[model samples]
Target: MALRACGLIIFRRHLIPKMDNTAVEFLLLQASDGIHHWTPPKGHVEPGESDLDTALRETQEEAGIEAGQLTIIEGFRRELNYVAWEKPKTVIYWLAEVKDYDVEVRLSPEHQAYRWLGLDEACQLAQFKDLKAVLQEGHQFLCSTAP
Candidate 1:
């Protein structure tokens, strides 16, 4: 059976640096185990949960950022498939924006640290190809939709 996970492609406007525009920053979390890879706030989906619900729940559980604190972007959903623990895994991501500049990110024990990074840095830290692609897409969506 395939493992399933979900999370938000969270970004804050006007926070990215070196882009000249500097209006979008992305969120990434460093895992506490395994390869110590960096990823968005996500984890295995609990039973009987909608994908979006899983995303929302995992975001809160992993990043301590609840649904009420973010505005999920409209018309954006992405899926990625990979191998983990010798089995297939699928992860879904939805674009979301942090509603307040001063809101603190409280991470759970599953992660060691979190960082808000701009396009280049975020892509670099994400490392995983599929994850970096997702971030790129999310960043593009934010840039195109900026007011």
Candidate 2:
């Protein structure tokens, strides 16, 4: 079976009049292992855990962002498939917005560093094609849905 994991693509928007999605920034965590790849916080789903629950749990564990700290944006979810460690892996992601623009990101031992970046830099650091695509999609989605 393919390894299944879920995570949130957490973002925050700067508060300013006349600002666009350009004010938005995404949170990425650098893994402590394996080429030190940077991606949103995620982890394998445990037995009996729902996909969304796993996503929330992993975000809290890896990024120290509690569920209460962000609002999960509806209507924006992406799934990516790839090979990792000689095994197929499926990762599901959902968009979320931090309630506070300056919310703290406390990284766990699983991750060595974290950054909040705009779309371009996030995509560059993402490196993987699929992840870059998802970040772009998420950015567009936010832009289109901005209030």
Candidate 3:
């Protein structure tokens, strides 16, 4: 069976601790192991959990942020598939906006660092083409609708 992962494309706006229609920033975590790549909070799905549930849980576990703390952007989801460890892996992501605290991010041994980046930097560091494309699409969607 293919490996499955899920996560949020969590973003903040213009230095405010709230979600706004303009000036967005994105959350990315640097991995502690493997190639040490940066990405949105995500992980393998566990027993009997839905993909969306895993996304929310992984966000909380990896970034110290919870689903209740974010406003999920509606009508936006993306799936990426690539080979890892000689097998296919699929990752699903949803866009969300941070709304409460800017608490210090906590990383498990799975990640070594974290950053909140503007769109371009986030895409550049994302490295994976599918993820970069999703970041770009999310930014475009925000810009087109922001007042």
The model with the greatest lDDT is: 2
Worst 10 residues of 1 by lDDT: 14-23
Ranking by TM-score: 2, 1, 3
Local distance difference test values of all predictions, in order: 0.88, 0.94, 0.88
Better of 1 and 3 by TM-score: 1
What TM-score does structure 1 among the candidates reach? 0.92
lDDT tens string, model 1, 1-51?
Answer: 889988888888763466656567888999998988999888778889999
lDDT of 1: 0.88
lDDT tens string, model 3, 1-147?
Answer: 889999999988763556533567898999988899999999899999999899999999998887788898888888989998899999999999888547567787788899989988898899888889999999998887776
Q: In model 3, where do residues sit more than 4 Å from their true spots?
A: 15-21
Q: How accurate locally is residue 102 in candidate 2, as Cα lDDT from 0 to 100?
A: 85
Instruction: In candidate 1, list every pair of residues with a backbone clash.
Output: 14-23
2 against 3, candidate with superior lDDT: 2
Model 1 CA deviation exceeding 4 Å by range: 15-22
Residue 92, candidate 1: Cα error in Å is 0.5
